[model samples]
Target: MKKLVSMALALSLCLAMFAGCGGTPSSSSTVSSGPSSSSEDTSTSGFENKELNIAIFEGGYGPEYWEEIVDRFEETYGVTVNMQISPTIGDIIRPQIVAGNVPDFISMNDNDTTGLISSMIRENALLDITDVFEGPGLEDTSPLKEQVLEGVLNTAKCSPYSDGKVYLAPFNASPMGLVYNKTLFEENGWELPETWDEFFALGDKAKEKGIALFTYAGIHPGYMESLLWPAIASAAGIDTTTDISNYVEGSFSSPEVMEVLANIQKIAADGYLMEGTVALNHTQSQTDMMMNKALFIPNGNWMEGEMKDAPRADGFEFGMTTAPSLNAGDQRYVMTSVEQFSIPAGAKNPELAKEFLRFLYTEESVKLFAEKAGGIYALKNATEWSKDYVTEGVYSMNDVYNMGDSMVFGFAALPEGSKVTPRDEVFQSVADVMNGAMTPEQWAEKVEASFTEVSNMAK
Candidate 1:
């Protein structure tokens, strides 16, 4: 990935964690030989030989409540799950793979690769799941695998293959949305805004009382798209995936795109964005919001979990919504992605890993993930949040669903190597505009320049 990144730009790739959420009880600290220690093995007998050795990343994305699913799988299969949990996922896997001691399974993919699974496939380091996902077992376990909203499969399948022969199953998904301080909005008698103008208008109102309108990390590439960038693309009607293609490099430099860019600049110029936003990490920005230092932030819907324990005297309530539209005509939809999980091709026990993944996708897992971790589940029985501003998000989507998924996926489905568009660079533009160094048109040109550089590199 030819990032516009240098030491100057930063991002929190794991949106599920830093954006305020808890995860699995990873076994990074506990040392074990193989399938002898993970939550997937509580029993000493029965399906003992069905033990699975899993190479999972510790912390961040794991669910603290995931042990129940692991225990269930062990009870049913009588297998011990040896979890090789590591804080640095790539570092942990690279050495083991080089030594040919590939674990039985890998938990998920990270952004620090040239799409590792595909590269591994070409390098012969991964297993081909063309047979597994196509196998009948998927239907028996997760019917939603078939009914999953379109983008879900893309995350599991990765690039170089989109015809389903999936190498991974989705364990959780974090669709980006507006995370607001429900208490803040209520105390001020503000309903969650339904349109972009309304959203900005609320910012003015909040500003009068010392609140920044919305927050986004202009520093990180992953969180950039994971939050505000797609909403910007949607505002411009650029179809993010299309703009991300090398075929049309000016996708984000059009007049429509600049207007969206201008709105961002306008917000900053009007003192709606928080001070020092450019220097803050995604975690810090959200923490600032949890502390009532900002009024709203563009964040994954899973953001609620991370702030559930905030010290708000009124127990801060958070809500989700698609980014308000550029105008009433653009569209009202949130940017979201598949956020799927996959097993590395180099795993030692692909079958056992598959079974374990199936167990994690159960209804029980869905509830724990949604209620405690604050994720919006793609499962059939997923709960609908009913209190405060969260309820507004659930009910508002029915009308907005008509706007369609493409509205939010423009940048999401972009091709590899296309670094320009709205990623973190958009935020840089936001900062520049606030500093009186660039106009929206100038910002758009700079974005065009970034895209041009990557496009030329591709050629």
Candidate 2:
């Protein structure tokens, strides 16, 4: 298996581009569509008669960004964009997809509960949009691939199959790890730990103050992947982590990985985790953490915007850090959550959908996204380009890249007719482990059994 390299170099360049920038811009001041002249000459020749049907999962980022971009795409191409966006978009579109009436483009994620993307991967039902990246970007003459963050497109998140063709396009690049209240840390003079030993030591200090060291969305154990995958890379190596993703035999039970698992088990066994954590849903866990019941929670940068209306401790502000390393001065890794976009294999207007996909990478569209969504796109230098529009917290989250490498986690796509999912094997049993109903060794053996089944299917 090939080792996935770090995106540190690309992020270093992004940092250099915004060297002296400071302060976040107000919404009103950051609402320009960018220079219209930059996009005036682009031709939409054959796409004039075509209409696009798009399905978007309206989550924390909201639908305003999508609506704005769709309008711009329609205006530029002289065509109609019929967009269906909802919080339950998957449930709404699942029937349509089964009836062979799939939308031209979709903006849901693989980890979504509907299992739509996972199903599509199993059935090989997604369109091959590789040319969209290989072709020129909407804003410039450079290939669109060059505009993406380094090491982002090659992952299973974009290319589900181990084969080299890309089906899903990268939407946003978000850093995921432990989220904490920055103000609390400052008030207590608590230092962020670099090594696991320091991490446990800090947990002891936090516990003295009646704060548990960690918690997570127990009902949605998948959130733990943000911490687990990166910790594995930091402790074992990227190669070993990649092997786990590829379902290689013994990868999960390897001595190094077992040690990482044991440490995670120690969190539960030693009472470092918050009490009743196993019963709380995502919102409940996050809300409690914000109220200062816990020192840190494994989560993504979106936690702030997602819980904006929820009551929190006074002066609470979001802060993110990479997973702790095994030894001092060892390399750390921050798992990046890259949402996806794709065109279905069955579509009325594949060409028009492809055009709309490319249109999203334009400077105007990128700026609108930042202004309306308060998030950065996956394109290179996007954080720098939209720095004025995003919040200070989000900007600071991007700085985590400087402390560690960027990692994207996705198991290779399962073969058709396979009965088990990687999530079912790996994460679903986390509650059992935390409850002491199953030991870490038992967890590893069970996961290896599932991996064996999947490996046989591939063979």
Candidate 3:
């Protein structure tokens, strides 16, 4: 998948450099000044006889749930939903969008390395569906805005432009942390660590037993940032993390940020990471943990489904938890990874697309999505919707509230052609520190320099 993304990104970059890929958003791209409270039924929305096109990203999950929802929608509204499913949805459909052909709805993720959806945002090609939330939900008469889980709308990823208008609807809630073998911990009589001191002590014990404390897949910043950033937020405080996320100048130079970096450097210097881990791809690192070559690997909730059939040690059972905190009584933050859905500005049936989105929050539709995909959407009480259907490792997060609430990587709007400064890139420094290529002090200096460059770009 990374290779495919690389190839597609290369092609897109070539096109962008030579063919002027900037999109002139049609006049229809204007959003309503505010949300509408109209009490209109789905069938009476003048889209009953139209076609609503949907393009969904098929990543480690089937579209069976979407198919079921589409069937019900067609039976109710007399509309045909042309559903196009592909693992390479970003690579294929993004080009069509660039050519002025658009789907009414798209579920591609902007966080993917390909940056397909980000490119569209830069081109102003996505519709603003703020009115969808103001409308009624599928099963109740209450407004959809009132049905969403709290703090979800607070996610900066929902509004990339930072203008307070929602261009994307957050769909799936995938929390990330250090995934480990529950059976292994039980057998070793090791308790899950709640603080940095205890966590490092466990690392010492694991080292004596020929098991490394932690390892991560490759040197990708996105992968490691999920684990480290939340831990940093918990240790340094969310305000500092927020400043860094929002591109506040010199935020990374804060003492709190430095403290988190020093602790991570200690882990690297102590030889707690598995040998050759920096070179391993995501699946290979996961395989190492599965085979008991390492004690824990940082990853998202999707780990179980991603490695369901892989070879593992006897009695292996997956488990996950938020990053261990700086102190025993500190507030721990669980880093969430959410997938998003959106409508194109020039979609043929924008109203119908929004109707389908609102229908997703319905009780029956939410249940069906969980049962089929083992994924939970962001509707109210969505996490508790179906326990039996939630994925294995994901189920452990049901107890996340016992520690603290969940938060995702901070979102900041970056200008076009801006490169992600090396200082903000966490994984590379992790790999470098672990491999003895850079000292912690040197790493700090590099980060300070990088952020300064980013500050210049913003100006």
Candidate 4:
């Protein structure tokens, strides 16, 4: 978990450096027209199969980027890419995976509700693609590992076993937090709150203007993790947050964490949460927030792209901020939402799949992704490199990294045959809390009990 601890500090440094460098890309600057396959000589040669099978999840970012990249990969290597891209890609691939007809590469995440990635983790069914990362980059002399943001590859998301080997490759690294309309705040002459006291005070002020302070995707309560993890880190400190991720016995029930939980409860109890928030799904909640029905929504940077075509209030513009701090000058934390890519343990063309993964980190692919999907890749300087391609709002979202510490939130992998998932134990109860069916103390106690179960399983 030292790697996990270092990730926050590493991101802080990356952001600081980015902030200090003020120069913009020149007008003549352009992404490479195509992927440079010269440096990929060793990895791409002599493919047993001239085809690479890929399954991608079409989430907030659409399939256009993947389609374009897959086409480029095919053209560069003279191969056919059989790609299955869908919002419910997990469902389409699950049966194939169960029958041992797994794809060469999968672009889904561990948190997908289909439990595909999590099941693979529990069964050790993912390919140990550590070499893919340790090998040289496709377009540069540096190792692929050196090209990515620091401390990201070592997390449980990538190295589920905590053994310094990466099974999952990093995809998009997005800053997750409170998303609001910058224009609305400016029009109202409202300042972003820096601490919880000011947060509640703002809630009161907004209430007078007929605006609720917060709203989240109620049906998918896990979305609240954008707010929850950062708030916990701000309240209890990063080490305590890591302790919670590791499922230490008292981490969830500790006094500081309980205070964070209580404040979350206060959002509901004090009527700071919007009406009908308990029934809204992600799109609905986001739409309402954009329409000014609620002042803020717990979400990530991709939200802007996802809702690009959706209706909004006059002068609507996306803005984001870290969770309110515990004290005026206390360091805040911005939880990072990292999607993943992995090869199944049983793949027809592991070598080719590895090559494709390497290609994805290339400057050409990174810029293409930013231009087509309006999202940044997980690689170092990706935002800065693609700033001209993405929208101004998406570019400004990177400022969250500069404003606060960046963190990735995931509990330690559960042992095989374990009956509980710590994430579900925590987030699933959020809807109940919002509805007054569960108290914050009860929420903490329930989560602690599940953690105890996981701890005992290790014994």
Candidate 5:
């Protein structure tokens, strides 16, 4: 239920939080590179041993897509899977878990509620899936294990401080990339930005040309929030993954972080950003920008496909960029995360949960999850995924695309905080500064407050 940070910037909060894992990949984007085709009959997945009630996520790849396959899992194991769709979903499904009402499998991991699993593990509510990745008693999961993308696997393993083990198996990968309006850039004699200064200077030019440069989902902030990590890392010269993921309160309020907000404010004040951005979600903002009335929109590559249908007359060519820093010498990160999945400890069948966890990593399952979800697969050696818009976007280091710095997770404005607080409180703290109701200092204070209130959850 927690919102995902951005990855190649794949995966979403079903439709709430969306994000993928870090860094702009090199010219040759990483994908299926480990194991090749499989000739195994993984048809049943050995789930026939239990009656599984799966609470599939809303807006996630539906059970319909894999129902037949799960049926095979059921048939081979002489079991039945009663798919229970989660009409109500988010980072934590504690109410259902507490009431003793739980599906066998529930797919939602954003590290926001990863605490739930950690807590569940304390009570033995879930199984330790270390075996899922480092196989011993498991079947030949090579194909499936190979299917999971690296970034996706990292996001899947984003949890820290667990006792030398894992509780989740990523089913797919989703990275974050900057989605740009290509034709507008070409029409205006603009090229995709390769550095941080280009990003802001172009805003000045685009403003003069009456173009609303970048509009993003401020109300629904996950991947959008994650974008700040690299932006700050690039600006602050911080790169250690440990600092990126779990840094303290004032860490994000530093000058580097302040500077990025200052630029965003400058862009907004200069009228380079779309109007009503504060009121808009990711889709709406993309709609306005792709309509070509607005020039550029900051979004995960997921928005790339949505804009593909925009009339070319409006000049909607798709391109991506990594968010920028103050200068070129700064250390950079792709600032990405994934929408991950895990089974609760209270799950009816921990062994069955372990089996389904294995099923999710299979080549067929990972590939199927990717094809339907449109992101990278989560694995040590993820499959090559350049064909799709989402996959292509994450590999922003390509010739056609480039980045300002390496990608990072985040320090400021995490998706988990947004899930705990009302989106309005989360966004208005930033909006208030842009609107001049709060200065950067006061805004920083308020931002910390909004975040600290949510941090209480981790405690």
Candidate 6:
């Protein structure tokens, strides 16, 4: 929470909407409050009671935190709260959307595999929550806009499609990069690398000691993008980086992209990654790091909490740093991954849903979320109020901001009908390149073709 990145820096990046891949709807539950409300006040039944329905994506963090919050909201407003929760909430809610029975409020975690948010965004099924931000906070009269940290509300995550219209509200703030064992480095007297040369040199030394230089949550190749994108931005410059996200023609074939692919190739060709890593799940690869089978892993701050119960080498301490600069003196940019919230355009109680979202952004509610769920608000200049709830290993995220400027690669909505997403393609090619199935040139070419295809569709 110290040395937080300024909002000014956050606004400089090009933000875009992310489209979700469509899939069959999953199982779900519907809890309703005995019915009736076409108005904000009393229902047609002439009852003074208000009712609201919310659906939450149940991820590793679970839904208890939100259930408690809903309890408080219900207590305060004397309303009946209906809850629909599931790990597959996105898939579960898709059919509901089709049936014209959308929940009043919803939170689809960033890790949702079903891509529900993206699908909804692509269909323009989400309400533009711009007015919610401009309105007052639930706890106070000040405009919610003023209460937000600078740049937090301006990013692509909030205004997907870059139309200056906010459909998603920022939820959790996560800094991602290279996570390693500090104790291993200290015990071996290896200084953290700050440049590519130093990084490779250390990798070589690590390899000699029977430790692979790098590994990732291979099952989730998407995670490795965090590690690779910053390196690309640092070497290529921000303009080229922006072009990549915007699907600019020939962006993938740029010299900067080639550099990124080449570096990745070098790692693969050099035999630097852990053996059999391309098949590992997130936790399995993370376990490799915990057990010292691999020296480092590309992960977010959540790794610490996610791996808290796993075994670790004695004196092991989690430490995170930005990817080494492309060369000495290059500007390093750390990536921040954010979780988001939104209301459906068809939400029956849009007013109540907006009020609930505003409450979530309030100082007290934010603190409660951090305390109960170990989540920090995405607001800039936010502090570590939930420090006690967070494990020490995750605290390494703080070191990243203190070290340099930070930027997030905002999720871009791929043009609909594209067979594959640029990210999915990048990840697939990365696997092929790492495994020697594709040459760096081939990878670059594939990516370029995908970029051109998406660009053409956008036109």
Query: How high is the lDDT of residue 281 in model 6?
Result: 88
**Candidate 2 at residue 165, lDDT?**
84
Encode model 3's per-residue lDDT on 235-286: one tens digit a residue: 8888877777676766776776777777777777878778888888787899
Best by lDDT: 4
* lDDT at residue 83 of model 6 (Cα atoms): 75
lDDT of 6 by residue, 353-420 (tens): 87678656655555556555555677643455555455555565667877656776765667776665
- Give lDDT tens digits, candidate 1, residues 303-348: 5444444455355765555666666666555565444455666666
**Residue 400 CA displacement from its true place in model 5, Å:** 8.7
- Predict model 6's lDDT versus the native: 0.71
Q: Give the runs in model 5 whose Cα sits over 4 Å from its true position.
A: 1-49, 60-64, 68-72, 86-88, 91-95, 109-127, 136-157, 160-163, 239-241, 247-249, 305-315, 385-428, 447-459
RMSD of each: 8.4, 9.2, 8.4, 9.2, 8.0, 9.9
| Candidate 4: 10-residue stretch with minimal lDDT | 17-26
- The alpha-carbon lDDT assigned to residue 254 of candidate 1 equals 68
Score every model by TM-score.
0.72, 0.92, 0.84, 0.91, 0.73, 0.85
The residue pairs found clashing in candidate 4 are: none
Return the lDDT, model 6, position 451.
83
Cα lDDT listed for each candidate: 0.53, 0.81, 0.71, 0.82, 0.52, 0.71
Clash list (residue pairs), candidate 2: none
Please report, as a residue range, the 10-residue window in candidate 6 with the lowest summed lDDT.
18-27
